[model samples]
Target: MLEAQSRHGRTVLTTLCVLALLACNRPPEIQHDAVFGPSHGAVGDTLWFSARALDPDGDSVGVRVAWGADDTSGWTGFDVPGKLESLSYVWHDDGYRIVTAQARDIRGALSNWSLGRGVSIGVAPVRPEPPIGPGYVQLDREYAFRAVSRDTSGHERRLRYVFDWGRGKLDTAAVSYPSGDTVIHRHTWRTPGTYEVRVKAITDRVGIPSAWSEPRRVLVDSALGSLIWQYVLGAEVHSSPALDEERGLLYVGCDDFRLYAVTTAGGPVWQFVTSGRVRTTPAVAPDGAVVFGSDDETLYCVGPDGLLRWRHGLADKPGPAPALGPGGAVAIGDESGRIHVRAPDAGEWRSYRTGGRVRCGPAFGADGTVYAGSDDRLLYALTPACSLLWSYPATGRIRGSPAIGAGGTVHFGCDDGAFYAVAPDGGFRWRYKAGGDINCSPAIGADGTVYVGSDDRWFYALDSSGRVRWRFKSDGRIKSSPALGDNGEILFGADGGSFCVLNGWGDLMWDYDAGNDIQTGPVVGSDSTVYLAGTDGRLHALRTGCRLATDAPWPMYRHDARRSARAGGPH
Candidate 1:
């Protein structure tokens, strides 16, 4: 009887030990209704669901998720107790789905399932419509483009857009818009070429991207200058162009507040932006640096690579184009009536105050003398050191730059409606009266013939003594200066958009209608091509079959094709 009692006691002791061990360990506890996810998602879209759980014994926990009745994910990697755990799932079919999650401790003790979450899965959004914009565009000018998309699943969703500008440029919208809404974007092209603009859409909730829209072809033109090719700029061009023969590039400024460097092929090479209108003609230095001034009261020097080499601040807006001097020095005049000269090597600058605003570009004599025309109706001469030499008075404002003749005579025009010749020593030589204001600079021929245009609508050829040899009538006022061709022909533009060429005998060789006001003068290229800027915002290149006059003194507006404003002849 004692042996039987011992056996029963052992069984009782084993049962009590098992109950104590079960009481010591606890299963993980999931928070009530803690499952979270988007309420709506597209079919085949990856959706994420999360849940939070806690282990009563401070053990790590892992989460297991179930979608509807058929799909269930294995437990995820363990996370700290009381932390949220997430899993991603893709539903192939559209339906109202219920998602729930459960948690388990490292010891494999599982928790009860959290409250279920419902999601309405549907089809993805449709591809966006192709972008709509101008088929042709001018370089560096911004234009508006638009696109639209819709959710084919009939769901109300916010959509985001992405744009490909075709030139390896891509942009994504920062904010999403409601589905089927037209999205507008602004873009600018810096280089000249053909581009394909395209767009795509993405749904904000489903995070699924739609297919890219059909591409829209856009032909971007440089618009900076053409018969071979024409480039269009952002605004009208009043500034003349300077050619770099070695690089086959042309530099010009525009009222659009930018300096553009374009290839002879009429393609954009690069651009330098300024804060103000760039009305001053660019001057090319011997070392390939381009110098110009802006109405922002500053002068900029850019290198051949379209990078800024340096810039100088001025007290007032520059009134005229910059002039390149010996050893890379530059000279420019300002509305404040100051002539600033910057030394090439030292980068140091010196200024000389004038009696009035200098509206005409300064010219350099063979002897290193600087001559500038001012609104004060005086032509002032100075040395390279900025020291005053002499001043010749005029009846009206001296608006045109001066041209130095082979005989050391200075020729220029005045608002007095007369073209004057001044001796090198500041003495008056003679003046030939015109019908209206003389605002255009003079160009000298090898045989000592002086050519200039007047606001009176006539271009005149004068002998060395200021005697009118002959005159040619134009369709409109002649404000554009004359450039000489290698064949002894004079080429200039008039206000009526007429680009005319005349032989030395004052006979019209030919004329081309530019379809706009030709305010800027023509510059002859080495290959005899002519470049002219107009108020129409195009640089027109004409194959004139005549080269620049190499032997003539002051052949073009600024003395040479480079617009260096230096006398003697082409460098």
Candidate 2:
């Protein structure tokens, strides 16, 4: 018994000594490499980089490339999709700024120090100078737009242009002009309106912006520039469709003017119809009511049971589509140049008038101002109470709708073959000229870049300052607005029934053709489905690339009863 106790004590001491030695010799783990980038960029712009790290063991390992930006502050990073490759970024903003990048290997390690190769990013690229101009044009009796001049620096300033119509603007690009100056040589617009167009002449040899030009007015026609299409409601069907998300079902409208609900991945479940052409896009109200407008000029609120709860009408036929605003008010324009704002229940409807036909829909600014165009060659800025605030003139008919962005920057295209940017106070910022008419609406990214299509068979990406970053030529005229993905992919349709995806830099990612003209805008749903209505009478729910299958039917984005093929909503 004495020997056994002694042996046990000796074993315990030996184990304790071994542990102490191991603890003293062990080293700390190394940190992973990191990458950083500009959270905002044009489609083809480079991502910035920064590499910082440390190894507790005093030994370092190289970092593997990852995804885009990693945080809300700017751009973040993620794991590389496949092959191991180094990544970089560039800045479109002025001045040099520091950005951080995170890198890693198969081992789950992290880095803190933003120093070393591939760890810390360098400063952004220099801004390309604006184009030069002594060019100008008169759009109509009310306004005249022109391109004055620019500064040449950075890359290459190539082109310049102006619009003085229903929608007015200045044009610029990073390309050289005839005078051997780096300038935005060609700029165009469709409608003429109010503007203050300017360009900073630039080139790789000469850098920075030059003196600005005085403001100008652009004229536009109210009727000719607008694009309207005939719509056919189901002669074989009767009911309106309810977009049921969770069930992947599309409630059908029947030929008997009744409703039919069906599964998206499956088939029809049920449907109900109205007394007239169910040409209206159904609105799922806050109270679970499926409200919609009709050719009968009556607005009806229906229960989930397909029962009508309440109905209202415009004093006359609402010749235009409706805009359902924040408060429960229904807004629509008429053929007689009148705009009606009404409550859900029947009562005296408020009306506002313009100088021409209210063919285009009304857009509400953040301050409750109403913007609508007319055949009278004017773009009227109106008060919420139906009073005219300001009127911008145009050269051709003002048919295009307007898109408002940060700081009240307005974007729209016109038949005058020009794209225009306007300030909140009804002044012009700039414009770009294209070879063809512009019927497409504009899409604004979080970074303030604007994307739009034109009848000139081209799609363009413009920077915040109205400079053309890049342009992609298409086989057919682009009448649709682009649908932007969370990952920065641009999805859109063409007049030739083609669907395509554009990378951040205006490069063609991929495309698909459905064998019919797709005049509707593509909508990106939460379930990753893309919805589009084609002239072939088919509603498509596809992946961003237009190859994957979808589960919904009606993808019309209009908030009113007129879900026509006309280019009204933002595509």
Candidate 3:
């Protein structure tokens, strides 16, 4: 019974082996399905193929991929039973192609090919070129500029061009590509200087459509060679220099107890000895006479030739720069707390007293009113007849001249670190807190921006509404009043002995080093020259790139009797 059972088991085993051999003898079956993603694509688009294959005989299967047009990644290694695969191809040329796949079993048996999705390629877009434009502009005047760029891509797109004016100003414009490569732009420079102008092209699809072309230098206003001439004096100069356009002479006072007349070429024209140091800026009269006060308790009037025309003794030392009013009337103040007015034709004068020393000079209004500040912490408004019209009290002593605004407002700074803008009727309009002592007069721009410097070492620009527009820091205290250039540059000096020029937006354009502290203000001549006095007793001359005014001149501390601090004309 055991033998019979063994034989039957052997028979069964043989039968199973025969069946297994028969299956192995049969060729492995291969079946695969594949699909290409993004059925349609551009010339540069990458296409993806996903494929699945099976071996009916339970043998390993491999995938062979073929991208039509000879684009193929060949066969993949075999796996057990079935295979899942993915392939990618980028269309380099513009055309249509079909992706297909086949499968092979471990027995080297091949199957029919399975078709994949079709893909199409189109032409790609081309990048545009750099922009081209002109490279020259005049200071303070607008110039028409044009820039050109083009797109090479056959497809239409929008292109943008950016113009870097190189003076803290920029502009952007967009146009239709292919047809639009040229654009017209206009700009005005507020200061005279050299700057580089360039443009870049861009598109929504491509970043920086083209590289920025080489920059072209634009020359502003002055073409004078870069030469700064200085005239050395015997003592420190705390006075602003006066310019004589007719003879190209500069008049300034020195702590050496003398007033000097210097040629614009930095040559000494002459000197007039005073009893004491002169700390006041010389005021030029309509008749070409220069008037200034000295700590010697006297005010000296000198002719354009540096000859002393007259001298008036004051009751106390005069610290304020003299002002010339309409009809040649001269107004000044002294430590005695008195504001003195002299008749245009004679030395006869009248005085108005304040509670504190009068170290600040008086400014005239368009309506014939006089505005002055006092150490007594008050700002006084007086009629041309010397009668007090009104007085506005401040928290600190006022040591600077009052500036009249176009709207009849009076602006001044005080020792209390405050700047006040009062109405013409002596009513408070607004007050701005400063970082430190506010002892400098404010200058008004044509656009109603106010400029003043502080002992805090900052120069501030305030709008007509009393809001700070911008502030620039200096190395030291800035007691010097800010002067406006014809082209909108702000000029001032610092106790650090540096003189700086700032644009209308409070950007520093340039600066010069003076050997000593500069407590004096700066002035722009009609010929666009700059005049500055240094505590080192030297007067420096520089180019301002402004046009000279033949109609009037900067005759006093704040330029005009109005003390608006606005130079040139109504602007």
Candidate 4:
């Protein structure tokens, strides 16, 4: 009985195998129900698939759906739809994650996965954003600057900015995202002249600083080819020098305790020893005698041979360079708060006790009224007899000498950072504020306009009302008084180590570099030749670009020159 059953099982298995082989050799029918969906979709988009089976016997059959997750994954069963032919699932939160679905007919017998009836489901890519901005930065005012940055993946981008002048910094500090387009930004000058404004833009990055914008040089005023300066005494000069044409010598003084005699060739020929450093220029008499003041509290009389002739002690620290009055008499001020008058060949005369220390050299008005400024911030008008006529208070200490104007106006710069035009009666006429201290005396023109430089690095032209008519910004501080050319151009020196020429409108005409500070005032020659000395121990000469001449110099007034002479004596 066992043998008969075994034979029967073998005969049935053999017949089934033969049938499967025959079916394998036949071609697939390839019939399928259609499935449709969006050609492209974001992650989480849904898809649909449907199919029906036609098996020679019309019986209910199971249709298994299968898919693969990656190149390493073998085919696995994908979930079937509950009641509808569509199935929805979120695309995994990863880029390029492969997804797939297949539809199969519900057949009673199972068959292998078929390629002809299935479709692929792939994820679409996403675009990433660029970073906000970079590191620290600076830009010019009104400059169109950009802040650029990139993503972790190295995608490039740019940023925008709003510069704030009132704050002297940037307007926005946000780590804002960048737009695809370029943005415009602007900066403005709060004051006229040349300026180095900074512009910066932060990127999307939280901590990185944006790069500085390209330097945009805006000229609120012209600064081209300004003058360069030179020196001849090999020391810091507080007073300007005088050229003794007949003797071909430059008489000047320095804080170095000596009165220097500089030859036109630019080297010291002789030096007169003083009890103290000579801060005032010498007054050369026809007799060749040199008169000046020394901080050692004495007035020095030096012979042309460079010998000290006399030393008149005032018993006070002289802060002013001596000014010449009549009869070779000299007027000098000291830190003792007194202005003294004495004869060139004699000792002390009358002295006036000013309210404060007098640092500036006194000016001789046409009528013998002395005009001078004190650390007390007052401009005093005194009689030749040493009695004060009036005392006017300025906003600050006045260092520059006061020039008498056509309207009886006195123009001078104050430590208040402004130039003032005051009436001889001690009334304020006008004041123009510069960006910095104006320690320079003003050069007055026939038109009532005033010219002066400030620590603000600017040379300015001011109207009678103290309004700025024009201004020129420079690369350095302007501490020297301006020498107006006879034709209306201006000459001045800058801490930038150069003396420059400017047109009437403040346009730069030419410049010469002396590579040193110029503390001396400029003098124009008769032929319009300009002479200025720098701390470099050289005297520079320029021509035709300014308004005054080197020959007939408009007195820079105070006790300004290393030596000033009118007919003869210290007066």
Off by over 4 Å in 2: 1-266, 269-284, 288-292, 298-306, 309-311, 314-320, 343-348, 545-571
- Candidate 3, residues 264-375, lDDT tens digits: the string is 8888888889889888877777667889999899989989877888888887989668877766677788999888877556747888888889888777776667788888
Segments in model 1 whose C-alpha atoms lie over 4 Å from true places: 1-226, 569-571
* Per-structure clash totals for the candidates: 6, 159, 2, 59
Off by over 4 Å in 4: 1-234, 285-288, 343-348, 527-529, 541-571
State every prediction's TM-score relative to the real structure: 0.60, 0.51, 0.63, 0.55
What is the Å distance of residue 208 in model 3 from its true position?
A: 14
**TM-score for predicted model 4 compared with the true structure:** 0.55
Q: Write down the lDDT of every candidate, Cα atoms only.
A: 0.84, 0.50, 0.71, 0.57
Report the alpha-carbon TM-score of model 2 versus the true structure.
0.51
Candidates, ranked, TM-score? 3, 1, 4, 2
**lDDT, model 1:** 0.84
Best by lDDT: 1
Q: What does the lDDT come to for candidate 2?
A: 0.50
Question: TM-score: which is higher, 1 or 2?
Answer: 1
Candidate 1 at 209: error in angstroms?
Answer: 91
Which tens-of-lDDT digit does each residue in 19-118 have in candidate 2? 6655554222223433443433332346544434433433333443333243213222333322233446443444333344443332334444343332
Considering only N, C-alpha and C atoms within 3 Å, which residue pairs clash in candidate 1?
223-231, 223-232, 223-233, 224-231, 224-232, 225-539
RMSD of each: 23.7, 21.4, 15.8, 20.3
Query: Mind giving the per-residue lDDT tens digits that candidate 1 earns over 316-368?
Result: 99966888777666788999999888765646788889889888888888777
lDDT of each residue in 121-185, candidate 4, tens digit only: 23222221222211111222232333333322123333434343333555674435553443333
